[model samples]
Target: MKQRLIILSDLCGSEKSDWLIYYTHILNQKYDLVYYDSCQLGNVDTSSNDQQIIHQQFVEGGIRKAISQLIELEQNPIKILAFSIGGLIAWRYGLLTGNIKSLICISSTRLRKEVYKPKGEIELYFGEKDAYRPPMEWFINQNVKFEVIPNKHHEIYTEREFAEEFSLKLCNIQSH
Candidate 1:
């Protein structure tokens, strides 16, 4: 069976995008990858912008709702490749279900705010220039695996090849 992988939204999240579809096509050779953008997961106002979606997710019950939806969609253990706020959501779910095989989160700054260690092997990637990045000692102290990518926040995963390659490596996944 193909390994199951779930990707959550960024701060400026989207449930779907041409970019995501294109990337997943490349990844599908090895895993069953699912991408959920903000628009698809919540009871979002159709007109809401990225900022509004991000606010609704953290401020309201958006995070919890997303978890519930994920559980309903797949009961078996899965892997996660998430970004920003989506990383936060994926982190929460990993802790909640303990079914996460591997979790890879990029630029998830808010993770510094909360504290819940999940069962999965997780690796966090951050741009050296992102102010939100936690200190290196913190990861060492917490025993969390992480790395500092070359670029700043916006540019960290800008290159499609880099994003795709790095994400797969983090999960120890190989695509056909």
Candidate 2:
């Protein structure tokens, strides 16, 4: 009865980020929300091991695994909300298969390298301070809907205000 929303986590790999929480609060009444954490590796406290494991698990290989996991789940039209590396992974996967109904990629600067377009309604967000972000002209060239949040970074997903603002965007999007 409710729309299914799948949230893919960032390179940092926390599926329950503030953005997720904010969107859940706003859309829970109408959507079934699920969090998908990418293949997790070592703890952040152990820097070297964490870096090595994360790189090994969540690179190109992890994108395939994430897509497989999504398809391997129940067959349903899913809306996706992804961050950073997760956004790139989701974009890659979504392009391969038309499984997503809509997609929102937040701070997924690395997506610039990908040439395939997704089969769903797509929107992207970036922060001015994001070092890896694609130029605004690039988004315009690609004709992808995007917004640039002022004076923020890739970590804006964890910020309460940013989350709340993003939640509003999601709310407004589904209303039509």
Candidate 3:
């Protein structure tokens, strides 16, 4: 049987996210993929496109709600490919439930607020230009592996080239 890989979307969820094809097309061939929309999981209102409004909703209560909902839905070990706010949800899930096999977080700037690290094979990627990305000291203190992609910004994961390259790298890692 193929390994299971869970994909958690960014705050935008599936709305206007054609870029997801860049990763899904490649990852589907090697794993049994399960996709989750962050907004739906968190019960965030996405009627408006204002990022600030959406982000505020998540900050108020959505993130916690999503984590709880995900824990209730997934009980077994999981490997996660999460973007932005989705990464934060996965991190909290791993911390609370502790069954993550591996976690790859892309552009999860909000992680700067976290102090404790979860137990898992964790990899974090951030754009060098993303001001909200956690400082190098945070990574060192957490003992987590991280990479800063040069000349990129917060939404770097949306790029097709980056998605393809990242999917290739993910395929090489053995999942349990």
Q: Each model's TM-score, in the order given?
A: 0.81, 0.81, 0.96
Off by over 4 Å in 2: 15-19, 40-53, 173-176
Candidate 2 residue-wise lDDT, 33-120, digit = tens: 8877654421222244464566566653666676676666635667888877778777776776777788899888778777667788
RMSD of each: 3.1, 4.0, 2.9
Best by lDDT: 3
Number of the top-ranking candidate, with TM-score as the measure: 3
- Over 1-176, each residue of candidate 1 has an lDDT whose tens digit, in order, gives 88777877665556333356545766677777777774356444445566765566555877777667766765777788887777777777777788788888888877877656778788888988888887776787668888887756634654577677765764467845
Q: What is the lDDT for 135 in model 3?
A: 90
Task: Report how far residue 16 has shifted in candidate 2, in Å.
Answer: 7.4
Error of 3 at 134 (Å): 0.4
Q: What's each prediction's clash count?
A: 2, 0, 0
